[model samples]
Target: MGILLRHIFILIIIGCSLSVTVIKTGWSEDLLFFTEQYPPYNFTGPNGKVSGISTEIVQEIMKRTGFAYRLKLTPWKRAYELTLSQKNTCLFTTGRTTERENLFKWITPLTENPIVLFARPTSTIKIMQLSDLSEYRIGGYLGDAAVDYLVTRNIPVETVRDDKLNVRKLQGGRIDLWVTGEMAGQALADKTGHDIKKIFTLTAIAGGIACNLHLSNLITTRLQQELNTLYQEGFIDRIYQKYNPDLPVPVYKTK
Candidate 1:
């Protein structure tokens, strides 16, 4: 009877140790990050590595947290859907919209993403409000919060696969205005050598990291705390300065 009891005790101890190891692995497994080719935020550089404003910020956060991770640059729609469906995955430089507020655990306010309307430099279109442009044709891209915002307001907007196409459409007079994030539009325009001017600032939303719903809150909470520390330490500011020294650094908002 004493020998039998000792074997049972050993089994219970081994089971408990295995359970703890499983829990630790679940929390510390390498994270996968997804992002789109929205330049100046997250994009593939000429060297073919992902590097940009939000990309750098996220890299710093991961480094400080000592989390093993891999980042991929893909189409916006693909990245959005993959992040939505996968566990232990995250999407960054995502706009924090009401429609997406509860979809994922968030680490936010990485950058200011002011939705704006860009028109050809010679164009005379004016927009005082979103409704003011009802008479004019508008263009937006897929997987962008601005597209959803327009559709929600019952606004008619032609859709494209990418924002760069909208820049081309605006240049070709196919669309009167291109609605997109301010910095992204500027970067695209500059890259394509097309001069576009911002005609209206529709609304400002913060860009953030959106982790999968099943992602452990423990990881999210730890990352959020590290992000806040980065902001407080002006590390985020220095990153923005490296990208665009003229643009004002976005203020961090804790949730």
Candidate 2:
């Protein structure tokens, strides 16, 4: 009986050790990050590696939290779908909205991304408010929050898979207005060699990191705390300065 009890105690010790190991390593194993080719926020470099403002912020969060992850630069639609359906998955640079508020656990307000409507230089379109866009066909990218916002407002919009196509469509007069972020629109315009001018500001929204519902609250909480620390310590400010020296650092509100 003594030997049996000793064996049972040893087994208990082993089990506890295994549990601790699993707890330590399981968070990293379960987390997968998804992003897209939205420049200045999340995009691929010439070497095919993910790097951008949002990516840098997320990397700092991960580094501080000690969470290991694999980030993939995927199509926006696929990345959004995977984050919606998969467990322990996260997507960055996601716009936080009322419709998407309850869908996932959000760690938010990473950076300011004001949505704007742009048009060709010689176009004679006047848009003073959101209601003025009803008569025009706006071009946007698929799986973008701006597209969803327009649809919700019953605005007419044509969506394509690539944002660069929207710039071309606007240039060719295929679409009256191109809806995109201020910074993003400039980047796409520069890339496509099109000089598009902003017509109206639809809304000013900050982007965030959205995690799957199945992700542990503990992990999310730690990440949120670390992000808050980043903001408080001006680490995020330095990152923004590295990307856009002329612009002010974005202030993210903690949830």
Candidate 3:
């Protein structure tokens, strides 16, 4: 009976070792992707799953790459910070700005959205130049490239946690203008039934997947290649059409 017990104990130890190995292997194979609640780009749908144009694009790319990944909807600031600090982590629909050029390894030009200023439809706000923005109370969201662009030019901005809130603020006369992406602004306005108009186009910006500085070049290269194929095959155009049939699809570049 003692001999039988010893044999059973040995089998248990081997089984425990195999389980640990499987767990570690699964963990190492998985990648984590983060994004904010930017609509028609990346957002939590009514069914509680993350689904949008950019989210769909990323999912297809990962499927092509055969890499296991987790997509999480988080605050913009937290998502950006996690991509910056965590390995095997990435953020999608990130603006590829000159100031951020050196911070992360990029798989770029996933989106070519123009940053713009929005205001109430009835407001007569003329913005012929960037300097004119300093005269009004400009509202924006935290960790957005549009806000950074304005702040770098010495323009003061009121920031909030969500860009959607700015639409309400504009309606309430709390802010004179709101700075955000053209697509995002329109989506927010339409969803909230707010009447807002684009007052001025700030600048055209390309957005993409931003990976940590320490991420493997292999993974970045694979994602870029897959994205290029998607663009060439018109898969991306279909995604854009599904979201907004009238909006022009963002051009993607191989380089």
Candidate 4:
């Protein structure tokens, strides 16, 4: 199920009544958004609609800021390409990296994601340093920052289009290691109904939300400030608890 780039110019004027509609005071049909299934963060619903913690946060910003936007679930590469080529388009739940820092005029920050490395529990491999696992095969998703971060260093790693496949493959003894977020990996682990603890290891790493460079500086500044505000107000932490009640997440700190 691939969502290709189609410029749907349909106006989705939301949060407005007839009285406000007549005045036409607030409007900015200038935003396009994209996402992919990176579960616990973003995922497709049973009804095939987009909904997750990240989506919820983005929706909140939309409601508060009145940024006219469209969300699409597509292959990461496609979404990234669209965001790069099309002005006013933004991709979310992207890792903040040195390579991509200058590319997108980021919306400061939107949410928090902790980058991590996971492994089957029974595996004898214990990693204290990234170089320690260089001799073994590592599995990561295509277009995922981990793959790019590792592959660029000439490390031996495999790329899978779907991260779930990596977990399944790891559980089946097809791979020696898999890298992903602890939260999402655990969610998939549970969804698969497998005792993953007997099956994975997790390493704490960096992840967050970013937008395309096309966004205005004002939006970027406001976005960052709002993230701080949301955290201070306990909104993000509440969202995390709603999605994950028990386990701890690096990004969701206690107030």
Between candidates 2 and 4, the one scoring higher on lDDT is 2
lDDT of 3: 0.89
Q: Please provide TM-scores, in order, for all candidate models, with all chains considered together.
A: 0.91, 0.89, 0.87, 0.77
Model 4 CA deviation exceeding 4 Å by range: 1-27, 108-111, 198-206, 246-255
Scored against the true structure, residue 60 in model 1 reaches a CA lDDT of 91
Residue-level error in angstroms, candidate 1, position 169: 0.6
lDDT (0 to 1) per candidate:
0.89, 0.86, 0.89, 0.69
Candidates arranged by TM-score, highest first: 1, 2, 3, 4
Clashing pairs in 4: 104-213, 105-213, 119-200, 119-201, 120-199, 120-200, 121-199, 121-200
Error of 3 at 137 (Å): 0.6
lDDT for 42 in candidate 1 is: 91
Which lDDT value does model 2 have at 16?
100
Runs with alpha carbons beyond 4 Å of true place in candidate 1? 1-19, 253-255
lDDT of 1 by residue, 107-210 (tens): 98788888988999999887777778889899999879988888889998999887889989999999998989888899999999999999888899888999
Report the C-alpha lDDT of model 2 over 104-182, residue by residue, as the tens digit.
8988768778888899999899988788887888999997888888889988689999999999999999999998888
Give RMSD (Å) of candidate 4 vs. truth. Answer: 11.5
Candidate 2, residue 109: how far the Cα is off, in Å: 1.9
